[model samples]
Target: MAPKLDIETYPGNIINNEFVPTPNTRHSINPATGSPLFKVPVTRAEDLDAAVEAARKAFKSWSTTPFSERAKLLLEYTDAIEANRDELENLLTKEQGKPLSLSHTEMDFALSWLRAFATMKIEDEVLQEDEEKIIYSTHPPIGVCAGIVPWNWPILLGVGKLGPALITGNTFIMKPSPFTPYCDLKLGELAKGIFPPGVVQVLSGDDNLGPWITEHPGIDKVAFTGSIATGKLVAASCAKTLKRCVLELGGNDAAIVCGDVDIDKCLPKITTLSFLNSGQICMLTKRIYIHESIYDEFRNKMVEFTKNNIKTGAGTEEGVVVGPVQNKMQFDKVKDIYAQIEKQNWKTALAGQAEESRNGYFITPAIIDNPPEDSQVVAEEPFGPIVPLLKWTDEDDVIDRANALRTGLGASVWSKDLKRAERMARRLEAGSVWVNSHFDVDPRVPFGGHKESGIGMEWGIEGLKHYTNSRSLWVWKKIFE
Candidate 1:
């Protein structure tokens, strides 16, 4: 059964395990119906100050806890989240409007991370002892850090940042996207009681509050996930104070269907990922380049698959493959792409339309046939369900064309011959490449971007180090008679 979308509203910032309403207030709407879901208090300058100060106060004690002890608490957190999985999933669907099942998957993925980063061998990895002078190294936590996350996969991404920050002993002040703050609040409500006061806090509001937090001198580091342009601003803001930044930004990921692959099976998967979260994802395959020998056949199959599979409607409805665009801005952006495509005389192989009598933010999936490689529609990243496909004559040409785009977060290669696919994957200029799958994230592996896609990497063993600073201690024994 689909879960009820009765969003529970919380007034303001959760600082030091207390909910105190601020001077400002805001409304959270359900994107599926464009109806007001909940009216909640917003963040203010005072709220931001309280959050930073709370984290600052907590850091004095949290930073000294044993890594093993911290690991135990993370495992407890995982258990608690798993026990209330259904409730958590409901909160995600209420404000965010993603399919409930997918929401659960996100939560399940988070549990694995809680344990992975928790049980990590930090003592072995960071602490080294030498008999000569009792030389050792310690991984100290960065002081009060702020984690600013985007709307897409809200809970999961927040957990991704949370797991590492806590395991490495950093107290945090988290701010979720205003578009979907319900789940973020739920996390705060639950965690405030479970963890120590001021150890982890949440602030929900508009973009203004976030900028204020980023520029706050009290914050030692800023970890964000959003657009490349906004990421640039975050990086710049942190630079002035010499504060650390971890930004996971935008990507115009490319998908290549080589000459030797089966067109019938792979085309469906390609169409599925192109509009994931309504193509709001940074790792989505926005650009598609096909081998010319099989280009015509692939395009036809892609059109058929897209038309049949990608259905858009209320996220809580049954049998819906994709949900409504998260809000009005998303809807307008998608419509703008449609209007632009029509004006350019570009061919739309499979076109989807918004339904009448529905007050929802929605759009059908689109499959655009051969467009000029240099055209903005093909070259620029259109973060909508619409995708433009291009054709190249040879394998090398396809590689070159795919790598031409500036953003390089993720790329995909589809082929039956493993060797060819592997070679092609290596040639694509991105942080991650998938041979058969489009977007699959593993906690044990490192995930990040290259070039304009963003900086540094997260996940894996090295990811834990991002929240910590290493200190080397050395002492020489004096030779005395």
Candidate 2:
């Protein structure tokens, strides 16, 4: 059963494991209905200071807490989330404008991630032993951490930061994007009794909140996920405090489809991947390079599939595979690209008109037919349902074209020939390369971006290291003998 949307019952920020309300508040609008979903505390500089100080005060003991105890708490928190999964997922769909099905998927992914971290342990490493001098290394939490989560996948991304930060013994303060703050704020509320005071906190506000947290000297690290433009600003702010940052930014990911592949088998997966979350995912395929031999066939099949299978509507509506675009800003951006396509008279294989009856930010998916390589739609990260399918005859040329962009977050090569796909995957300049698949990420593996896409990594053991600093311990033989 879906949970009720109750804005009046909204709880404020979670600071020191207590609900902290503010004099000022802001409303989060439901993208699907263009109506206010709920009101959240409008956190300001002073509020951020209080949250940071609380986290700082709590860090002394939290960081030193036994790993086993911390793990038990995290596991308990995971259980709590699971028990309320339906309620959270419903709220996520209402606030974030994703299909209810996808919202459930996001919840499942987050639960799995939390469980993974609950079972993980970071033990000291013995670098050298059985010698005159013994050397070992210890990974310790890096004080207070600020997790700036994006709206696209709020719950899952929030967990991406929370799991590592908490498991590694760091007191964390999360700042959810103003566009979607419900689930994250609720998460903080749910964790109140499970985690110690100020151990896990959440603050919600407008644009000002991010700068307050990032620029604050009390924060030891900033883990951000957003656009490349904002990511640069985050890195700059963190630099002022000499704080560590893990950024997962934008991607203009490409998928190279080979001629020998079975078009029937691959078309379903390709279309789904390309338009997953209405093509808002950072790693979703934005550029398609198909061998000229199969370009026409692939394009036709993909167009037909999209026209018949993909439907956009309110997230609560049944049989709706694609939900409305998250907000107005992104909706305008997508419309701007459509205007460019119309001006250029670019050929479109399939164009689903925006649904006007819904009175929301709804734009049908579009497939541009072989636009120029240098066109804005192809070069820039549209981060919308619109995507370009280009023709490529040569492998070397396609590889070069795929790598020409400033971003290298993810890419995929599709072909029945495993050896050939492997060879091509090796040369694709991306943090993750897949053969005949795209955007399938696991919590156990390291995930991040390359070049301007991001800095540092998240998830896996490497991600845990990002939340900590290594300390070297050495023992020297005494010469008293």
Best by lDDT: 2
RMSD of each: 3.0, 2.0
Where's the lowest-lDDT run of ten residues in candidate 1?
1-10
Please write out the lDDT profile of model 1 over residues 264-289, one tens digit for every residue: 77887888889767777888888888
**Candidate 1 residue 390 C-alpha distance from true site, Å:** 1.4
Candidate 1: Cα lDDT at 25: 79
- In model 2, what is the error at residue 139, expressed in angstroms? 1.2
Q: Candidate 1: TM-score?
A: 0.94
Q: What's the TM-score of every candidate structure?
A: 0.94, 0.97
Name the regions of candidate 1 deviating beyond 4 angstroms: 1-7, 123-137, 354-357, 477-481
- For each candidate, how many residue pairs have backbone atoms clashing (under 3 Å)? 0, 0
lDDT of 1: 0.80
